[model samples]
Target: MFRSFPAMAFRTRCPVLDPAAFCFRPSTDLRNPETVISEPQAKVTLFEAAELLRNDEVVAIPTETVYGLAANAFSPAAITKIYATKNRPQDNPLIVHVSSLAMLEEILPDHRIPPIYLPVINRFWPGPLTIILPKSDRIPAIACNQPTVAVRFPSHPIARALITQCGFPLAAPSANSSGKPSPTIASHVISDLDTKIPLVLDGGQCYFGIESTVLDALRSPPAILRPGGVTFEALKEVLGMEELQVYKKHFVDVQLEMTPTTPGMKYRHYSPEAQVVLFEKPIPLGNGLVPTIDNTNCKGFELSTMVAMTILETDIESLRSSIAHEVEQLLSAGNRKFGILRTSSSSLQDITKNRGSTFKSSTEFTVVEKFLGSALHPEQVAHELFKCLREMDAQGMDVILVEGISEDREGLAVMNRLRKAASRIVTM
Candidate 1:
């Protein structure tokens, strides 16, 4: 019943889907399902995008979290194009996107949603939460051969409309090159995947600006494989998720990484071309009363007084000194340009003023600073993290210094991505 669209023919026949022609109201709420498209041209564009998917062509569609490179989940041929286009690792599995619970039922092995996920589904469906379930015969093994497949019900109207129009579950991953930062806006997808895929349904900027919170409810205690838009606190509030565990740096699983059941597990993900250096929050001493600097690689700089101050007090100055020290070291290695992703509300003027007082005039390196929202509001940080990384990378920075945030709520997911992206971690 399903026909495969030849990659060459699909590319030649279908012109790039223009974002100007296709626009939708930006909303993440699942209950309110009114009109999504603003212009009539968007309807025609949506149909053309759906047609490409029906014919097994990979189409870039926007999700509430990020844009996804989608293809028919049932067709191995279609899924193959997704892998080739993105150069994604074969071992890393793709998450299937569904429009409704009925579509989700069609992909399960027994045509029944897993009992463990019923409560979670009720609360977080049509959101940024992804659940892994047993795969049916219809879903190709290339999608996920490990007996289970990761699936999501995206709240983005264009993504939902496209999936519903195609009349099938779509296996879609973040519409960017493998291991690179995920695309939050349609332009990010077009920039990374230009000429690689046929159509990218431009649904404007994604609300979450990250990936979905992937949960494997099949496991005991139900661990979150990858944290994203959904916070652990939110999921823990769910009826059966009181004991939800997150697979993070402290909780390392070798077997899971070797054969990841979900995406963002086994690979070096959320990275930019420039080297990322993450400055983590200081950890408390063994007594949990006093804070201690775990590591600060600033040689020849005095940090005794800075270390004595409480964790909260050691904010901007400490970070500036550490970054200046790092830049000085890199300067010896002949590196010129540097970028800093600030977590605080500090402005570029503040950084510039401090640079004059901090670094020697003789040090001839350029430092560009961009704020990633305040630490008080972690949601703003999450939304701006990847975009800042890409922007800094585009500016030809040799190194990027990211000031880490407290691991609470959305900060947990933010730190998770930073940990994976960072080549070096500094505790301050």
Candidate 2:
């Protein structure tokens, strides 16, 4: 029988205020890898940290997806706390983050990892790719509200450390409230989730701000499960495999109204308390999330170009020219409080000028490329978009429109962000 998630805090079994649950320590070096606490004496030694997690206690573990409120995958009760704290939908699955291929065997039932996927995993694991395979009888169906579970081996050191110390695989999801921006820093987890969860291990910010790229390799056709750190193009580029696009149903579960599958699918996930809309065609409107109704009652919303576009791929110079043109349209529409931020590609160039390097190491170029660039693959671009948006949002901007990326490979995942991040959509 599936267990009911606790509605209240797990204070009795696990006290949040207990001194034994937390320890403080001082480290002047801000970049130290093992540093978990900010204040002196707040750092618990590894022994204490292991005991804290082993006791079915909640600990905020950092991952590339966001900080996950980790619980032993084998402990249903402990896992329940994660659901309770996040207020996540029970039907949505929880991803299992393992430390290594060896740890994966503990959860998997000797099923051979797929041959095609082997190279994909080799190229992507310890990073952001989540693969869904046949579930063992051992898997709890509640993980993603699906029979097949999502699993990944995170590349984050602190995330792996907590799991190794506890000696159990962890079922984790993005630590913020479900459908919110994933927590990239320990402070982010603390800000959004600290009160509800137990201890948060303060590692530095995540290199990649979005969730992992998820693919369902168990199926014959092989579905791109969910787009994140992994891009579909990267997968194809690395493996030289052919990808068949799967058209996802817009509304599978009515409880979500019209949200798609996956955790954030049921609701408007990743919105920063601001409304986002997507437009099939460009519209010069700045209103957040209100349904756009044409005279004939055709409904639509403006999306950040970042999410809704499958713009022609070009070089950095052409890309910049195109964006400057778009930005002019947005500015002409009376949308002010303006700023443009780029985490990855900033060009408007045609796709012909693709040079597979990460920011070719010049400050002036990184700045220029951030605003105007050429062809950008999803994996290359998805790395920094969210964090850039959040920072831009903080600068007191009202409406921000971003361009979308190609929908091949990890592009599927990039398109996911483009769809979700905008308060509206305008496909140009």
Candidate 3:
């Protein structure tokens, strides 16, 4: 018979089966050609999850940004299962999730929070922000893979409650197959990790469609290794981070490729099934193909030039034409259906209007458009980005064309994710 561990006693007592390690396994090894499923694992509850964590098993839990494959940070065997289950790179590392400052302190070497991160924690903690700090011996080496461990206090009630009940931190990474889009809903987690893990706590769709921003405060001047729900502007606005630097934007650090300080720094992440092509923000041109026309100038322009200028002055129109050209080329090459992740400034109507009459007549070409929020509200754009990409892939789009936004505020994270998702880029 497969027996479930009791939540009350499980928390206080180490696994009875293993003397060297604390972990739980059924008496019968089903996958060993020995035992069959006496009982199926049910949708996990907080109590069940706490018991499971006590027994050193991995579970799927929800954070505000995405679902996570969580395991007891102290258990090497449990952490190994997470890596094997996700097929995550061994060196990629994981973020340690804490429920409170006390739990966070329990895992730190000196039990002292880094002074540089205090202000950031005051503002962004219990939200979507991850900070890097020195790794402690309490954390298994596999969890960090480097000298420092990434930590965050998740805002999700279930996530925090689970950690608090387990009486320890959880080392969690996005709950999905490696290189796949992070799971925003429990079904996404089940789809990817079914039959591998014992339980998945069904949390609804994540508030932010992307992961948390990974910031390294251990370094001088500080740096953002990955952009997600938290914006770089928010970090900069923090008292101690007024002069903070973001990797790649402020300066390129080549060493990161060889030895990544954070999880996202050395991986190809959040890619969809179809190829993505990103178009940079369109440059506004004035009449006659000159810069925006001012009342002061037009003496050198000709009537025909002005007429041409009138046809394509708007940035949205220019972007539409550029994508339409690409669509035409793809149609000639035999791609049938295409997808557009539209920005507030551009839409399907704009692209259709720009498609040449000849290209519009082609029956083979079909275009699907999804408005991914707006450039003006990058926060909403960030929220919809991954979902849009996954949905487009499901729609069988031969290729996805995305409109780029400025790298400011949440746009910084939006563009970072876009660049990674896109296989090719066409700057407008």
Best by TM-score: 1
Q: Considering TM-score, where higher is better, how would the candidates rank from best to worst? A: 1, 3, 2
lDDT of 3 at 151: 91
Question: How close is every model to the real structure, measured as TM-score?
Answer: 0.85, 0.66, 0.80
Candidate 2, number of clashes: 73
TM-score comparison, 2 vs 3, better candidate? 3
For each candidate in the order shown, give its overall lDDT on alpha carbons. 0.77, 0.56, 0.73
Candidate 1 ranges beyond 4 A from true positions = 1-38, 283-321, 345-351
Total clashing pairs for each candidate: 0, 73, 0
Query: Residue by residue across 245-293, what tens digits does model 3's lDDT show?
Result: 8888887878776777677788888888888888885433344454322
Error of 1 at 157 (Å): 0.2
- What's model 3's lDDT at 107? 78
lDDT against true structure, model 1: 0.77
